[model samples]
Target: MTTDAETAVFEEHRPVLMGVAYRMLGRVADAEDVVQEAWLRWSAADRAGVREPPAYLVRITTRLAIDRLRQVKARGEAYVGPWLPEPYATDFGDTVPDTEERAVLADSVSLAVLVVLESLSPLERAVFVLREAFGYPYAEIATMLDRGEPAVRQLAGRARRHVDERRPRYDVDPAQRRDLTERFLAAAAEGDLAGLMDLLAPDVRLVGDSGGKAQAPLRILESADNVGRFLVAVGGKSVPDMSFRFLELNGGPAVLVLSGGMPDSVFQVDVSAGRISSVYVLRNPDKLRSLASA
Candidate 1:
């Protein structure tokens, strides 16, 4: 028999576990699976025998996430094109009861951080997430991973350095990001290559993922000129009646929908100092299935 207090504790910590799993695995579906497994372990525990419920649950969630990450890595190695993180339309106000905590969680869940996390190994990723993102102490992390303290420290250090090297400092204001996204969409919809060029950074790159199920740019295009040319071609080919709707994606603004009401693509805009740094286009039909289901 489960006590009311245990149930309350489970509800209290569910979001945190979800956040950790989401960051570690980069997929909402996988994260949900990890959390569900955590719940099973928690429910099966002998309440009188175990103590520190929150930590116990987190340990279970982290291990499960690490396992999932390994599986995802194998899939990515065989994947046809770029693999992007899953996007979620989070209503923070409704999901988080506390205003201050909600703000912190929202920042941690941003797309830039999640995308850069792709570079870390499964164990390194778990250690970094627990230490940096969740503020777990080295000793606690060691216990969770069943490793020595020195090993945990090494993993976290390597993970941190990798992230620092790959991801630029992201400090764009939300209002500015929204404005830039709107401008880009307007240019794209109108097939205004000149207008679009003005928004892209000099070294901007575009990566498209179609998973061989839909038409997409098979390879990554570097430099602003190539990206501009490709966008112009796509716009010219698209039907005149196509519409683009801006939605919250990976905690940033992104576009969805195309001509004849078909799901088109999901884009991640990297902004540096007010200009678009890069654009990641995810067109994989399997990846887009969630959007279709929604």
Candidate 2:
């Protein structure tokens, strides 16, 4: 292939590569870095020997992400509070028309799932991302990881079991989630404690990630009462100039609060049985910086 042809091939698969990397690492910056490294490697590779471009690119991105994830884990950076994945803008556009496939993608990247994935071994995470999120065959995954097919299968099984055991169940219907999310934001913004309580599940859990750079609960808040009151109290203390914009993020509707035209925080809810079962707040300034530019 000529230079333009090679570039076109890389660009065509960029989204899939990004999706794989992001799912593997759970941080946008790190995922992008991994993808860039994959591009460099791809561009320098002997293209004539590469018959399957998509698989080759995915393998490169996944390995790079595994390396990045290992480095991040080694850093031992203490999280200020509940650590949530950096909110990613997920717009499937016209490419993903299948409902079930989209749901799989969304659930795989949800905050709760990503948090659970953080506990997985790097190889396990890579297997899960490839087999679960992207539906790669065990043979293909084994080749990508340079491991035996049986070992890859085992890794996939273990990762799937772990994720299935920990990932919270939520309704996947976008319309239902959007409706509840809108009501959720309205209730919190108005300081309507009763309204907020009504929307929360009895055992609803709230996890706020602030990284100690902003005001947020330093511990997880559980139960409808506790989460509701905390939200109302925080709302009461919020400055008058705060504003919120509703947008689809991480495959669902989310509230983006802007303070003076800058991203201040993000609020997203997980609805189960038509009530909010979990609420995630991202207040870490480092995490919000990316959204500010969006």
Residue-level lDDT for 89 in candidate 1: 59
- Enumerate residue pairs that collide in model 1: none
What are the per-residue Cα lDDT tens digits for candidate 2 across 31-137? 88999999899988999999999999998998899889899889988887789999999988778999899998888888889999999999999999999888999
RMSD of each: 2.9, 1.2
- Please provide TM-scores, in order, for all candidate models, with all chains considered together: 0.87, 0.97
Score each candidate by Cα lDDT: 0.79, 0.91
In the range 1-294, model 1's lDDT, one tens digit per residue, is 667888889989998888889889877888989999998888888867767888888999999999988887888666666656777655565765765555455555666677788878989989988987778999999999999999999999999888878765654566787888888877876789899999998888887878777778888788988998888887777554676677776666778865556666776677887888878788776676667644
Please list the residue runs of candidate 1 whose C-alpha ends up more than 4 Å from where it truly belongs after superposition.
1-5, 74-77, 94-112, 239-242, 258-262
